[model samples]
Each structure stands twice: as structure tokens, then as C-alpha cells.
Target chain A: MNMRCTKARRYLSQAMDEQLPPAVTRQLDEHLDACRECRDFREDLALGRRLLGATEPSLSGNFDWRLQLKLNQALQKAAGETAYPWLEEKPRGRGWAGNFTTAAAFGLAAVLALAMFIGPQGRVMPDDAGRYAGFETSRQVAGGVSDRLPLNRGALAPLSAPRGIQRSVSGSFGLGDFSPNAAFVLDSGWSGNHLKDLATIQELKLRNQRLNNQLYQYQQQISILRRQLDRPDSNGLDLGR
Target chain B: MNPSRDEHRHGSPSAARFDLVETRDEDLIVMVQDGNRKAFDELAARYKNRLFSFILRMVKEPVLAEELTQETLIRVYIHAGKYREIAKFSTWVFTIATNLVRNKMRQRSRRPQLLSLNPAPADDEIPLDPADPVADPSEEIQRRELALVINEATAAIPEKYRIPFLLREVEQLSYEEIQQVTGLKLGTVRSRINRARNRFRQLIKPLLKDETLLAELEMIEARVAEQKDNPS
Candidate 1:
């Protein structure tokens, strides 16, 4: 066959499928009209299409039954798969080390929570010198305290000794890798709900300050009564001075 | 393409008013994307035979074909969310099937099994047309012979040619659809299909020179030509 016949026949199958543009169909039809060889080739593709299209087998004998079983298993497997995106299937693998890390993360969160609760109370169980002591500040000194508590400083400091890993650990837990303070403080993190937390902590500091004044006054009265008991009076019986 | 069909596909509230059976494949696939298992089953029901037959012919083994067909459907279910409506659902499905078949073919090429020691099972062989069954006794014999010839001719074609050929001839995909499915350039698709059809015609046409079926094939071809020339 000539080159035109060769080119025309390439599009014949497409023409049969109605896939060709109308212009090409017209050209192919014109070519087929002139060329018996190309016509026969077009006939061949049609015959092949009919013959091969007929050979599509029915899905006989338990095909659906087997597919249903497999589909169910696949569904179960998919449902069981974790929805959360993780860097690894077993994030660094579960063992003592992983367990310890998880424990440390929770422990750090608990300490932060405790500090948030107790910081404004102004009652330190221990001092920076590592001595058990109580503050004996004058009432004049008490009025100078700030409305907001001091920076978390020591409470927020290097818990678990690895700052970077803490962020990732919470990240893996879907706690969001925000600022370090937000990581543990969670709902009360400064990045979120800060105004509400500030109001709460400020109120607690004021209440504690008032309670401290009362405690100081009562301590002063007890000291005075002790001094009176110790004093020598004209008709005084020494009552266990 | 219709506005009403658009409403159903876009997951509008009105979509719920229509039975999923009335829904188009693209819309049904949208439902599938929304985690509708029933919609997935509807799609599976529609295409299982086509997928099974295509894979069966490609792999030339019934059990493997069945497995691959199931794999393709399950994948459609599992990854339905990833299917964007940029192409026809059939195109997306065939692309996935083609990938699986390609991978299987690659693995099989490495550790090629030279032959099956046992005789080919009769149940699993290329079957005669069930739709055209219980015909004239002599006609039945001719039909089976034609089917066998066609199957052999097609099986003999090279993989590159055979895939696009079957997709074009059997699955009736457009040239662009064939390109999408095979990841072949459009030029490559046209050329390969032409080559495949050439080989197929050469192989099967010469073999059917027997007196009985040649007349019938000729008549069919003539009717096809007549229909093409005289549009109703």
C-alpha cells in the first residue's frame, strides 16, 4: 500500500470508534473510497473489534463471593489502620526507652500544671538556697508584688533535658508542635486563652495577698499575748511564762 | 455535562433525592469518594466483567486475572478519595489496572516460567461467546474456531502492541484514553495500535481460508461497509 493508505489506515480504527475529528473522517472516507487495500484494512480492524469484543468472559463461578471476602478483609484492615499521620509505624519502636520518654513527657506536663496552680500562692516549700524556709516579709513589702506571677522560669526550664524531643513527642501525639510553653500548658498555654488565664492567676495572687495579711496580724497578736504572759504585774500569777 | 447531573455529582443536597443507580459513573465515584461503600459496590458491579475480561486476556490466566481484578476494585475503594474528576472514571480505573498488570508482568519477566507441565484446563480457556450460544450446530463449530483463531492471534502480539490494541478494540477506549491508560505518547499509541492491528489481521485472516467461515466473515464485512456508506 502507498503512504497515504498507510496513514489513512492508522486512523481507520479511530474512525470506527468515532474518535477522529470530522475532517480526518472525511479524509479517511475519501482515501478508503479510492483505495481497496485501505478499505480491506479498515474491514480488518472492525472484524478484530467484533471478534475480540466477543471474547470478554463472564465472571463465572464464585468470583463475586471471593471478591466480597477479600474486600471485607481489606476494609477491616483499612479501618484498623491508624488515622493519625506518623513519621513511623512504631514511633522509634516501643520498649523501655520509649516508655520512659512517654513517662517523662507526661511528668513534665504535670509539673507545669502544678506550677500554674501554686505559683501565685506565694508560699514556697523550698528556697533557691536549697533550704526549707518561709518568707518573713513586712506587710509594707507585700503591697509591692506584681499583679501577674513571675515568669515560670524554673518550672518551665529544661524538663526531660531535651527540649527538641519534647516538641516532637507532643507532635506525634497530635498535641501540636507549637511553642514549648503551649506544648505542655495545653488549653491554658499563653498562645491560647491567655487573657482568661491571666485573669485567673491575677485574682488568686490578690486573694493570697489578703490571706497573708491576716496571717501576719494573727501572728502579731499571739506574740503580744506571749509577752503579756511573760510580764511581771502587781497581782500577776505567772501563767506558764 | 447536564446541569442536573452536575447537582448530583457535586454532592449537593439534591443528590440524596436520586437513587445512586440513576447517577453517572463520575457522580457515583464522587459518592465513593465521600466514603459511600454502596456507591463503590455499584461501580464494582458495573465494571467487574470488563475489568476481569481485560485482565484475563492480558494475563492469559483466569485465577491471576480474578486476583488482579479484585485488587483493582479494592484499590478503587481504598484510594477513592485521591481520584479527582479530571478524567473519566473508566480512564482512572484502567490506569490503575494497567499499573498492576505492568508490575506483575515485570516480576513475571524476571523469573519466567518456561511452561506449564499440566494440560491447560478446559474451564479456563478462551471461551466461546455465551451470548451467541445454542445456535446452528455447524455455526457453533465455526464460531468456536473463529474465537480460537482470534485469541491466538491476539495472544501472539507483543505486549506493547497487544495492550493498546485490546484497549482500543475490546475495551473500545478512545485514542487519548488509550494514551492515558498506557502512559504512551499519542503518537506511540497510534503507531502501536496500527502495528498490532496489522499483525492481528495478518495472523488471523490467513488462517480462516477454509470454505465455511470465509463466506460468513465476508458477508459481515460487507454489511459493515454498507452500514457505513448508507447512514440512516
Candidate 2:
């Protein structure tokens, strides 16, 4: 082998790695002596190796402190967030107990509500059927009364104004006079023996009015209940009053 | 010489020691797994400075390097059980470090577009205070200038070559050990190092004047001699 060629090949990897053999070392020395280009190449290689060696960047300052601080934080986080082995190993019976208590309380509340609304006195009577029929008639009357009175008033509104006065007025005159409370106030607190007979008549009339109001409320609730029940998946919803 | 049982047997001691040290890494991991705070502290004391330097070099930004280093340790703790003894512990640790830096670079590339919505930070605004204060001003300036040149040149090298270059040149990993770390063929590792050195020479030629290069080498030799003499 040509010594120059051997030297040139050897010079490619010789800065200060002690692992290089003596023959290769001798070749590198000889090449550096002869060739300026090879010599310059070796120098550049040596410089890069040196600079990179120094560039580890001491990390003694806050940068390193901050890093250790972070490592501690990470260790802490790992310790904290680790899944409890017992959770997977042991059954979670507490959840089942909580669910049981919630379900029992709900069932108890529903039974109590059922007792209040639909038990004994709350039971349906023949009079209730009659009252329901009377309620239907009253609804029809109210709806017709509203339709005849004005275009804007609700269908279930009561009539209080004189039919003649309602016909003449227009432009957002309120149906406030049509409220059951307003009408009930007029019927309540008036008296005399001729007026007691008149008062008895008025009391009977007010009783019918109250019964109508109660019936109307019950009907509205029943309709809402019916609509809810008609739904395929009501999910046992309770529409509390 | 063709390799034989005797040579392999001789090699086994260091390999056994490697296994022993690896068990230490595992023990540290197990302590972390067991939630031993003291063990974590000991582990941190042992590996913190070295890992920080490794990550800092790989990522090239102090804050990001610190972040990756922290993340790697945390990962080691969290994934202690997953750490099989298939490779040396240091190799595995560096592998984790290398992956994090690569991921960070990828994330940065993705972020530039997203960050267009936000005002960009000024180049000088990102602080990079070198932890060591150089005793000589000339050496300091030269070191900084050299770092800049090397950083640019290193980008041109292929990643395969770059990893080994960083591992061997920057990290000082030995040839056989780097082979063990990287799982590269020995011949492949040797050739790549040779090529890496060649590429580095080509890259630095523009920045380093002839006399300046010689002076740097002389300083390295002097430093090496001093370190040997002191042996602290």
C-alpha cells in the first residue's frame, strides 16, 4: 500500500481518541506533515470535537436547580396520582349503598305523595265524575265567552266585564277583570235577611265558582299528566306543583 | 482474531457490572414505584446534573431542556414497571431523552403556525445564561462562537449520524457501549462516527481560521493534561 494513501485514510479519524492503533497513529502524523489540506481538515475536526466537548453547559445555575425542583415535583405527582391498587382489587360496595339509599328515599317520598293526593279523601267519588263533567261544561263556556269577547284573550279566560262594554273597547285593554280572584271578591263579603237570602244565593253561587276554579286547575294538571304519560319514555318524571 | 468463549468470558465482567448498575436503576425505579420520597431524592441527586446536561444539549434551549429532563424522570417513576432490563439503564434513559427532544422539535414545528395568532417573542428575549462563568474572556467568546457554528453544522448531519455523534462526541460514550446503547452494527457505528467526524470538519472549516483551530486544540490538550494531573 502507498504510504501517502494509507496516511490520508488514517487522518480521517484522529483527534484524541486513545483507542486508535499505533500504525494508524503513525500514518496520521505523516499525512499531517506532508499535506496542508489534510492538516487543515484535521484541525477543523479537532476544533469541532473540542467545542462540542465543552458545550455540555455546566447547568449549575438556576436552570439546573429548576430541573431538580421539577424532578421532585414529578416524583410527587406520580406518587399522588397513582391509582389505588385496592380500588381495582376490592369491590366498591359504598357506591351500591349510596344508590340504595337514594332509591329508597325517592320511593318513600313518592309513596307519601301518593298517600296525600290519592288516598282516602283523595280518592275519586261519583261526585268527582259529576264535577269533572261540570268542569268540561265550564271550560267550553269560558272558551266560547273569550272567543265572543275579543280576539286577543286566552281561550280558558273567565268573563267579568259587561258584554256591551267589552265590545266597544279596543287596543290592549287588559283581561285583568276576567280573573277568578276579581270575580270572587265581588261575591264574598255582602249581607241582610233579604240580603241573607241574597247572601245564601251569593254563597251558593260562590261555592260553584270555587268548585269551577278547583276543577279547572285539576283538569289542567290532568292534561299535563296525560301528555307526559303519552310519552313513550317519561322515565318516571314528577311534575311537582 | 475470531471471537471465542475466553474473550466473551473476559467481556462478561463489565457486562455483569453493567447488569449490576442496571439493577440499581431498577431499584431506584422500584423505590419510586413504592412511593419512597427519599429514594427519589437519592435518584435525583445521582442523575439530575447528568440528565439535565444531556437534555439541554439535545433540545438546545435551557427552559425546554429543563422541562424534558423533569418529564423524563417523572416518566421513569410512573413507568418503573415497564422498564425491562433488556438494555443498560443509561442507554434507556438517554433513549427517553432523545425521544423527548425529537418530540419537542416536532411540537415546535407544529406550534409556529398556531403561534402566528400570538405575538412572537424576540430572539434575545429568550434567555440562555450559560451556568459556568469562563475564567478567560477570549475562551468564552470562542466557545460561544464555536457553539453557534457547531449547532448549525449539526443540523445538516442525518439524525442517525447525529444521535451517535451527540452520544459519543458530546456524551463520550464508547464504541462498543454505544453499539449496545443504539443497537447498531459495530461496523456501522464505527463508519458513522468516522463520517460524522468528516462532516463536522467540513462544517466547521468556514468558522475556524487555521491558527485559531490550532490554539483551540492546544487548549484542549492543556485542559486534558491539567485534569489528569489534578484527577479530582
Candidate 3:
């Protein structure tokens, strides 16, 4: 076979789909006329195409209805999800149950908040006083070391305790008397704890600032290294290595 | 107001309101995006048979083909809003259908026994017209046998070629459109189709040597010669 035969066979396939240019068509026709092998190849390909085309299957009768039903269901499902995203979060038939669960959760939260704010005495002070009373009672019973008066009563009562009683209570509880000097001492202790916390926080902040500065320096070094590596001279360095 | 009822009350045809049948597939898809159920149904009805035929040929199982066709249309409906006007709507839909067929083929390949190389003849072959009288019973039998050989040969073609071949031959898609559907380059599509044709010729060569086919070829050649002489 000649080169025309090769070109003609390629044109044969293209011609089946009417994809060949007119110039190529003329050349293919001439080649087919002169070449028996190319002509037979063309004819066989044509016959195969025709048979395949003839076998094109018709769709079954119920195809449209079946497809439409499925498509409608899918569209409806998509629509439901779009309308309410929470519907998708719950399984089918559990939509209302989901809402009910949410409502119950909010109701429980509100009830807890109301109980914390408004105790049985209808005042917030009673709740705070009761908590302090529980703590003092636990400490007194557990230790049984001091014959001190209950601090809860003294703390909640009007500031009308006699000075002698206050002094005795302060000695028994190992606390200084409620005087300006005593207040200054307590303030110093409280400030000491607060200052220690502040110092630790400041130390952490300083360390974080140092780390950020180091990170910035490393990043700058990386950028410089990247620029050097990107240069063509880096190739020479590698070759020398 | 109920639009159909209002149209009837005004003594106007319902089709005059929208004229969905005359609308293009892309416009129909746009309408579907705008929540038009009728438009979606129109698109589905238009492509149902063609899509089913393409999938059926690829998978060679009617039930699976039907399922795949339904899934493909459902995907189009769900993703109607994502359709861009740059590509033809038919190309996009066929891409979905082709992908589904490819996935099913992949799944079937996992269980090789289920992947029959030669499936039964498609269920929906166009029945031969009974009104046309046969010249002879023997000739008719030979024609049917020839058809059987053709079907078997087509089924035996490799999936890579068979898809483009059927898309070109039966569905009448252009090379570029076939490329879009199958995601193969234009050159690959053409080469695969050519290889498919050659493979089919090789498989059906024995049948081609039969007397009936030779006679048919002779008649075709004779007609061509007569046409050349007459120049009608």
C-alpha cells in the first residue's frame, strides 16, 4: 500500500461522520478508486456504521412516567431542604420532634436561670447568704477547733456587733479586727495574689512577644534563602557540591 | 389565583401562556431554576428516550439503564441552577449520564462475573415491519443472523471505543460534543471511534463474507455506477 492508502483510511472514518473537508474528500475518492484494499475497508466501515445505526433502541413505554416520578421526588426533597436546612439535619419524620427537643432545651435553660436569680425567699440575697451559710457550717463541723460565732450571721447581720465581741471573734477566727490597719493588711494579701497573677500573665505576654519576633526573623531569613535558591547561581553551587 | 383556571375562564389556551414545548432546553433549564416544575418535566420528557437509549447501550441492561437514566435526570433537576449557558444543555446532561454509566461499569468490574462481555440483545430493538413482504424466508433468516452478529460484535467492543462509537453512530453527537460528554480530547475521540469501527469489522468479517452481504454490496456498487452514468 502507498501513503495515499494510509491517508485514505483516515479519511474513510472521517467521511462516515461528514467531518472531512471537501479537498480531503476529493483526494479520498481518487485514492479509493485506484486502491482496492482501501475501497473494501471503506465499504466495511460503512456497513458496520449502518448496522449499528439500525440497532438504535427505542425506549420502553413507561420510561417517561417512571423518570418523571423519580425526578419529582428528588426535586421535592431538594426543595424541602432548601426551605428548611434544619429539616435535613433530622431524619425523615423527625422534624417536629427536633423542634420539640429544641423548645424543651430552651425551657430548661430559662427555668434554671429563673431559679438561680429568684430563690424561694423571692430575693437574690437569700441565695448568696444560703451558699455562704453552707460553706461556714461545713467548715465549723469539720474542724471543731474554734469556739467562734457563726460568721454568716455576723456577715449578714447589721454592723452593730460590740467591739469586745468583734475582738473576741477576730481572735478566735485568727483574723485581725475590722479596723483600717486590719483592712490594709487584708488588702495587701489580696493584692499580693492579684499581682502574682498579673506578673505571670505579663511574663507570658513577653514570651509570646519574643516568639513573634523570632518568627518574624525566621520568616525573613526564609525569604532571603528562597530568593537565593531561586537565582541561577544556586545551580552552580549545587554542581560544585 | 390559579393561572390555568384563570386562562380557561378567559377562553385562552394554557399553552399560550408559556409555550414550554417550543422553548429551548437551556431556557427550560433556566425556568426550572426559577422553580418551574412544568419546564423541568418538559426537559425530562424531551431527553428521556435519548438518555435511556444511550445508557442502555453502554450498560446492556434495561433495568440498570432505566435507573441510571432516572438518576441522571434527577441530578439535572437538582442542579438546574448550576447550569451555565456557555455549554450546551445537552452536553451537560449527557456528561452526567456518561459519568453515571462509567461509575456503574467500574462497580460491575469489581465483580467480574457480573460483567458479561456479551449481553443479551437489547430489549427495545425496533421490530421489523410486518407489512413489508420478505422476498424469501431464507433471506430473512440470513438477515436476522447478520443482525445478531452485528449486535454481538458491538457488545464485544472495548468500553473505551464503544462509548464514543455509539455516541457518534447512534446518538449522532459531534466529535467535540462527544469529547465534552466523555471528557476525552478530540483526537482521542476520533481515534477511539476509528478503532471501534476496525474492531467491529474484524469481528464481523466472517458474516461479511456471507452471500447476502456480498450481494448487498454488489447492489450498492451497481447503484453507485448507475448514478454516475445517469447523473440524476
The best candidate in terms of TM-score: 1
Question: Which DockQ-derived CAPRI band holds candidate 2?
Answer: incorrect
Docking class of 3: incorrect
Q: What is the lDDT of residue B135 in candidate 2?
A: 43
Compared with the true structure, all predictions reach lDDT values of 0.66, 0.57, 0.65
In each prediction, how many residue pairs overlap at the backbone (N, C-alpha, C within less than 3 A)?
0, 1, 0
User: Compared with the true structure, what per-residue lDDT tens digits does model 1 show for residues A1-241?
Assistant: 2238667877876677676898788877788888998877777667666667544455755666677788899875553343222222565558898899899999998787667535643444445644323212211123332222224544323232333322111111112343254433222212113576576557545544544555556765764554343222313234577
Residue-by-residue lDDT tens digits, candidate 3, B1-232: 1233223223244434557788788877876665556778899888987887788778876677778888998899888879998888998999999888998999888866544675765654322234224235664454445545566787799999999988888788899999988889998999999888888899987867677676754544454466469764
Candidate 1 vs candidate 3: the DockQ winner is 1
- Report each candidate's C-alpha RMSD, comma-separated, in the order given: 22.4, 23.6, 23.3
Per-residue C-alpha lDDT of model 1 across residues B1-232, encoded as one tens digit per residue: 2224335334454443557676788878776665556778889988898898788778877677888999999999889889888989999999999899989999999978767765665663433334433245664465556666666677789999989988887787888999888989998998888788888888878654455565755644554466469745
Q: Write the per-residue lDDT of candidate 2 for residues A59-92, one digit (tens) a residue.
A: 4445445555666676544433332222233445
TM-scores, all models, native as reference: 0.57, 0.49, 0.55
Which digits, one per residue and each the tens of the lDDT, describe model 3 over residues A1-241?
2347767787799888988899778877878878999889987887777666544454556667667777768766754554444447646676888889989999998777555324421321324333423222222222332222222333333233333222222112222353234322221111113465466446545544554555556765764554444332343123343
Pairs of colliding residues, candidate 1? none
